[model samples]
Target chain A: MIFRSLLAALALMFVMSTATADQRWQRVEAVTQALDNRVPELEGLSLELPLVAEDGSSVSLSVSFTGSLEDGEHIEKIRLFAPGNPRPEVADITLGPLASPANIATRIRLSETQQVVALAITNQDRAFLTTRDVRVTVSGCLVGGGDASAMAMANPRLALAGSARPGQPVTVRSLINHPMETGLRPDGQADDSIEQQLVESLTATLNDEPVLTARFFTGTSANPYLQFQLTPEEEGELKLAWQDQKGEQMEASQAIKF
Target chain B: MGNLFSDHLSAVLWAGALLGVVYGMIAQWSRFCLLRGLFNRWQQNDSRRLRAFALAMAVALVSSQWLAWQAGINLTRTPYHPGNLPVVALIVGGLLFGYGMALANACGARSLVLLGTGNLRSLLVLLVLGIAAYMTMSGVLAEFRLWMEDLYRPTLPATDLTLVTAPLGLDTETGRLVLAGLLSLALTAWALSSRAFRTSPRDWLGGLLIGLLVAAGWWITGVLGADDFDPVRLASLTFVAPVGDSLQYLMLSTGTSLRFGVTVVAGIVAGSFLVALLTREFVWQSFTSPGHNGRAIVGGFLMGVGGIMSIGCTLGQGLSGFSTLAISSFLALAGIVAGSRLALRFSVGSSASH
Candidate 1:
């Protein structure tokens, strides 16, 4: 029995050491799947993250791409992944032609000390990637183990900036407050009891035509906040719609005259 | 049209400039240089200036602690109290900065004040220092700085001394308050112990007021500077990065918006120039010789690199970082003292030496 126990203990140590590396491999595989199994160049993408995070609930992250786009190619989509969370995919952002390459910033919920990766896909089906390791300590805000608070469904708020000039880009900032309970969080009892209830899909529309859309996962921070630019061809009311994992929807709209 | 003067970022910038002006004026009035304080205390057996610094530290400690508690500001939010300890970089950087200050005869903060007083020598020092700082911070030398930072990085259990009292069953606030209070008391007592320091009213005022300003810096950045949608980066007075930032801002104003650090640096120059004019202390000063110029260049470069590596200069690490009671600050303080002592010992009153 003692010999068996020693072997089990040694196995545990091996598993513990290799866990992070395994997660990293898994992250690459997930990104590959997202890119239709096309291997990325692994350059030009700059993923910025603090080496150590004092807060797990709301850690700021930014990514920028540096390489020049070819004559016939532009970035199609940029995706963020936090593999340690219940859902690895954090955000999927589609860029307009005028959007600056790789300029994206948002907060993420890190389940633990884990690697975050950003993948940028070009129109030519080429991919560029970058990664950063963030160490999350004892959380600075809400610990992940209390009773999942009832989705208060805090009112969604929106701020519109820049003149709504026809054919000119206008910046829209919006937030919908929610606990964003990951299915992996404990519920004051056993761990991994809280069911995930995150703002899953967000869309911005002008004159009932989709301008921008994003799909979020548990890694998206509590009280999901997003900022994006939209160019309107004519005067119209801009609408932002959000849907949670439970199919609950909340939105705020602002009228813009061009 | 966007409003010109009432946004939170602008408010914070203006507050920073005002605070910087006060800092510049006081530093000029009191001749506040840590190297000079050490030199006077060691070589001349005079402790007044050193006492003033100690008192400032005490005041900064107690009041900043109180502010953190009252305002619900997490000290760990800033880089100085980050849980990881970059031991090697702090020690080497602190030593270099200390030694450079000895050779240059002023810390980065004092260099600004001197520059305002028409000291062309300080202008050279500031230029070299700013470029070197930027090199270490984000330019070519950043690779080496990052390598050194990661060489033997160890994460501490807690970010501060409160970790020490945790196992003893004391809560974090209780532990923090007890430790901070005792340290403040001890330092305050030491500052007041010297009768010479007690008699120098200017020194007393300098220490007390500077301490208050340090605490005020926390409030301005942490409280007034905070915004939900677009938060200003929480920081206080640290000359190394700000000096580099100021130089960059002058060149990149059209591309980059004004920030608290850049504005504060500008305020220091403006305030110091105004004070020098008011006090008639402005003089076009230059190096005594090419040897002196060479020494200033070397010293300035070392200070710039060292300050960036250490994450602060004397005032940055010794005063601002110390106010938070971070263990890394203590290590930095020790390294700086050793470096300063080494420089002082080697100088031998040469013309090239300060």
Candidate 2:
């Protein structure tokens, strides 16, 4: 498995180096390659972020793809990258067959000013990408410690846009309590085992089938909040499952009617 | 979608600016100011303005606590609830702010209102104040400020009145209501005790409207701006950092995100300008002498630096921050009043105070 991963990384590097003259992509190629080996095309994709961020800890991010798809074709995955961070891979989200709108919004961390990139891929092997440059400033006035890490992955809250009609895509927002601890604290935080602990996995499912699956990393902000869209074929329940790197898990569900 | 603000933050800005317009108009008409209240009471033996200010505080405290209960907005998330109290910063910063108020005879919010009424000297004060705030916040003095803040993080179990009443066997919610009710009642009774203050609709109305405005600020930011996608900072009426933020916004509007505070700053100016013109009060005033101009500049700098340290200005700390009943805010207020009194004694003789 280690050898295979190494080969995959090298292949992605070769493809990226020959793909474009834009060195910006090349700089963060390793982090971006967590999605796939193929270079992404900047088409039918939009990534919105503030031009400047006062707090590098958590900056709001929104990415959406509204491209024309072939019959029966659907989006497969979407990934976010912040190369400036200690761990650049922010999150990887997979959309299942039932999902319609590929719009997703979440918060991310940037250690310094850098270009943040978002990539989306369709099941038909088409990849679209976009990037935004964010200038981060030192937050002089930051209060409180952080979210209650003790309750990490405990309660996952979900909000759905009501008045859903058949075949109409509905927006769903999910937020779960977790520190997303980077395990990068300095000496006196009392976190002796300064190892990377994170909410490694999350999934949204309808009828036990996946609607959206996301893999979170240290680059994701605390209390991971993800907003996405889903289209329901009928009245059913959508369940969200979350698990941290420690293998601890939590589940929550919201019923849909119409 | 949560709201239009969920997709875009412009709605939040507009709402904040509208509230600011109301604030500016009311402030202009009523001459509502804490420092003015202090100066007037000290020099002219007029406690009406001070009573109005106290009434505003009482109203803000009661209404804000009420909103938090009904709206389910967590007050703990706000900066007013610092995890580890910076006691030294509060006292020192408050003292400097009070002294600066005496030097300039106005705080940051008052300066903005005066500027709208065509006081060019206010323009100078605002520019310097904004620059000085930035200097202390993120410029040369930022590192020092952070260092001091880090060093002075005194671990306090309770930081606000709600927490103070927790030991009295009441739950958090009940404690909040009990303290807020009692304190607000005390302030209101004292404020209205003076027949002069009771009869003066201008002072009472100013206090009442501004108090309601603070609560409205919480509603806009807490409810309307409560988008999971792009959330606005949970805030109410304040003039300290926002004054500095407005200046920065002017220089980097395109490059930086538009915050609710900056728009409110703009709204206050535009609102005041409109009212001034309509009321035939639009007379441009500038520093009559170099000494006066120098005082304004120094006052601006002191306020900028001091406000940043204390985490608010007269309105920000004395009223808005105080409304939260944060213990540090209480200390800061004490420091400010003392600072202003000392400045009054040293800078101006009893005869000159008037």
Candidate 3:
């Protein structure tokens, strides 16, 4: 009886392993192919994510791109993808010349153990890619029955230092409102899956130059908040714009004086 | 100052008043006592009161799980489960806390209600517990606690009780809810069947009302306290931190937001006072001697230190922990009973010698 039970357990383990392996390999292939097709010139984008996340609902992510965004040679966009998720493509952000050269921080959710890919696209349409393996023990996004219509567009709020000198790194805090539906949650009242609706892009421009840009997905908080540092050359207006998957847009501008 | 009475403020005040009225009516009628569980067992050799407390735990466990099921609330994500077990600390902390509760004749929540009736002994105990809790929370004893936490860690890998049930091939959530419900039902049955317990409406009502209070705490923080800019931690009444938090609020009410625990603590005192006044139970009572006062103070200090280390006191761990049915609570509860019994034994031995 013991031997039979052991054999049955081993067989079950083998089946489970094979099933997971097949799904993961397929996802890996699809992700690689998508990266190859979409952002081919990927390089220099470094993703800093926690090695192990206890809760996947608010996993912190930081992306920093090295090298200057000089005239005609700048970062055009950054896209984040969670290959394991049903909607594998999480977010894509477009950057303008006035946006910061690099550095963005946001939270994302992971369904399970999966690779998070960050792809940076340069002005020349070259895509540079980097991937990190994140193990999400239990998905945190499984709250309140994943209903698509339950998501409400949140108003973004910004807070800046009251006073700061030129060339000093001023902290700019921004929070946006949105439910960031992951599309994998079973609908509360329906048998269908909740359609993904997450803020795809955020751009911060200081004096018509890109100061920072970020890509986000459903794993982000209900209302996502971001904090970043910008050494202002002079007191100027910081223009912020964010767009979600449904093409909803919100913009805010703040004037800073030293 | 303009923002003080704004819509948010009105909502908070109304919420507090509603909570206060409910708590006053229920707590006054029920006579909820966390210390009674251990004391009854030690002094009377009766498990009925303890069983009632356990029944409350069972009810809390089932109801909390039900709420979680309905709201999709995940207890595993909370700070209570840091994914690591500090076993030695929990056991030691539980024992110390139990002993203190016996010494003071009340736990933290009871102290608040007792204070409302002008029990000067409880007032000293509250002060000592609060000060000592703060000391341990961020002051001198914090380093020692952290060092001990690091030294005596258990290898269960994860501290969450739900994780243990997850591997049984049963639906993890369903398994947890069933386990919680069954435990609660068993305790409830045991408590209700006893002729003595059934006859005592005060005790049974107290258990039920306290269970509801624990549930109310979860709703306040999880739902009402939910904010995009600043989200409150999902918590219920746990006495150790809240006592310290209440003291801090008194000094820094301007800087901090109104938390549910603090509001609830305030409400309980006000409710109890009103009840006492109405019932003619509002008497200014103090210890006969400074020696008794000193004992109360020392008891409160031990409870503070122990509660902080254990992550809860009698009410905090007893009711709140029982509500969650988190494995750590079981261990802590056992330790508490053992500690109280030890204290009672020593006292009896000393009296016999005299």
**lDDT tens digits, residues B116-141, model 1?**
88999888888999999988865678
Candidates sorted on lDDT, descending? 2, 1, 3
Q: After superposition, how far is residue B342 of candidate 1 from its true place, in Å?
A: 0.6
Q: Compute the lDDT of residue A201 as modeled in candidate 3.
A: 74
lDDT of 3 by residue, B293-347 (tens): 7668878988898887787877677777667656677767777777777767764
> Which TM-score values does chain B get in all models?
0.96, 0.96, 0.90
Candidate 3 residues lying further than 4 Å off, grouped into runs, are A1-224, A227-258, B1-21, B45-48, B155-158, B348-354
lDDT of 2 by residue, A51-95 (tens): 888667788899988668789888788889887776678999999
Q: Model 3: what TM-score for its first chain? A: 0.67
User: In terms of docking quality, how is candidate 1 classified?
Assistant: incorrect
Report how closely model 1 matches the true complex, as a DockQ value: 0.04
How big is the positional error of residue A40 in model 1, measured in Å on the Cα after superposition? 22
Model 2 lDDT per residue over B1-354, tens place: 245554536777889899989999999999888888998898899899999999999999988888888998876667776777777777888898888877887888888998999999889888988888888776787766666666667666666876677777888778878888998999999999999999999999999999988888888888887765456778888887788888877787787877888888988988888889999999989877897888889989988888888888888877778777788788889989998898888874453353
- Predicted complexes: DockQ each: 0.04, 0.26, 0.05
Instruction: Go through the candidates in order and give each one's C-alpha lDDT.
Output: 0.78, 0.81, 0.69
